[model samples]
Target: MKLTELADLYRRMLLIRRAEERLQKLFADGQVPGFLHLSIGQEAVPVGVSSALSDRDTVSSNHRGHGHTLAKGVDLTGFFAEILGKATGLCKGRGGSMHVADLSKGMLGANGIVGAGLPITTGSALAHKMQRQGHVAAVYFGDGALAEGVLHECLNIAKLWSLPILFVCENNGWSEFSPTDRQLATNLEKLGKAFAMKYRSVDGNVIADVAAAAGKLVGPMRRYPAPAILECRTTRVRGHYEGDRQDYRDAGEIAALEARDPIRLAAEALAEAGAAPDLIAGIAAEVDAEIEAAAEAALAAPLPKSADILADVYTPAEV
Candidate 1:
């Protein structure tokens, strides 16, 4: 990749990192309502995969999906506003943190259900195939969702029809409070092979590695149009939700995960690739300012009007 492209990746990853950090603080301060899921240590998965996707391609996101949504080109202001429950949000504050969606950007919303995105992604890919649009669908889900029966059904159908879709499993080691190994006996690669689908596992913390793998896999899927699975071994720095006690986790696990922070890893790689220290610093400052302004705007934005509660709730019949 060119220097500019690498810089853009780093910038995107940094934006996710900083944005999540700020959200954690905001949630702690009681600014954000409801439970919040932060994809802090797992920035590379979305940044890498999204780098290979076009705006024409669609993506379905899981609950901890701010990074995925942002990487897929959703506006940061609207994202923050939605999380803040403001009227100007992507879903007019109705979707909150777990349901932000922007169809114009090909982001099909972040799902609250564990494995909901799997079938949604498959359906989108099927539509692309039937319409001959040549577009692919990428779905982001966690290790927890791996056991969901819908995932198996989606994979089976995707392979059966050779649909163009990417199933990205962000294996963050925990299925909520329990370790994933304790819940699911089968590994992702084996699961893919069982369904006769292509599979690849990459270190999810390294942004460059993720981008290259996703590009290689997704590029072929767009052309040949077959289902593929990319399992990214990642870390979930925050608890399952904001204010989670997290008594289930090991004492030093979070600290160790922080040591492998994706933003820091990407920044280091960018530096090794000859990006200037000053340039990296400038980008960080710019992202910080952008997020700060977005938060301020979201805080000042009005809440959804009570009188118009049913206005956008349902579709109307054609005249």
Candidate 2:
């Protein structure tokens, strides 16, 4: 990647970090309405993967998907408003933190259920295949979703049909409060082979590694289309959700997580890759100001009115 591209990735990674950090404070102050699952330490996976995608391509994001949504070109102003439950939000405040989406940007939606995106993206990829649209579908899920039946089902279908889809596993190794390794019988590498799909695992903290892996798999789908799995070995620093004390984790282990922070790693990478210190510092300042202003606007935005509560409902209220 060129210096400009690398810098932009740095900016985006910083944006996700700052945005989530702001939400952390908001949720703590009782300003946010719903339970928040933050992807604080997993910015590189989304930033690197989303960079390899086009606007017309679709993304089906999992529950912990703020980074996914933002990296996929969702505006910060509307994103903050959506999480703040404002009427002007992308989903008109209906989706909130967990279900936030902007279909205009080809973000299918951020699902609340684990592994829900798997089938959604699979069907989307099938549509692209049948229609010959030459667009690839990307689904973002955590290692926790490995146990879900839908993961296998989707992979089988995708393989059978040669669907143009990318199964992105952000393996933080945790399923809510428990470790996923203890819960799952098989891992992603074996699962990839079981499904007869191409697979690559990379250090998820390094943005270049993720960008390269995703670029190879997702970008080529338009022509030499096929199903592939990219496992990002990332980390999750926060609790499963906001407000949990994480007493389950030892102090020493929790302290170690700070060292693995993606934001810091990305900055270091950029500097090592010949980016000047001023450029990197400027990017941070720019992202920080942007997040602060957007958060203020989202907070000041109007909440959903009680009278218009069911405006965008698909199913009948009687049901």
Q: Top model by TM-score, which number?
A: 1
**Candidate 2 deviant stretches above 4 angstroms:** 315-319
lDDT per residue as tens, model 1, 1-319: 6778889999999898888888888888998999799888899999999999989999999999999999999989999999999999999999999999999999999999999999999999999888776789999999999899999999999999999999999999999889999999898888988998899999999988899999999987766889889999998988898888888998788778877888888888888889989999999999999999988899899999988788866798889
lDDT of each: 0.91, 0.91
TM-score of each: 0.98, 0.97
Q: Which 10 successive residues of model 1 have the least lDDT summed?
A: 307-316
Model 1 residue runs over 4 Å out of place are: none
TM for candidate 2 is: 0.97
Candidate 2 CA-lDDT value: 0.91
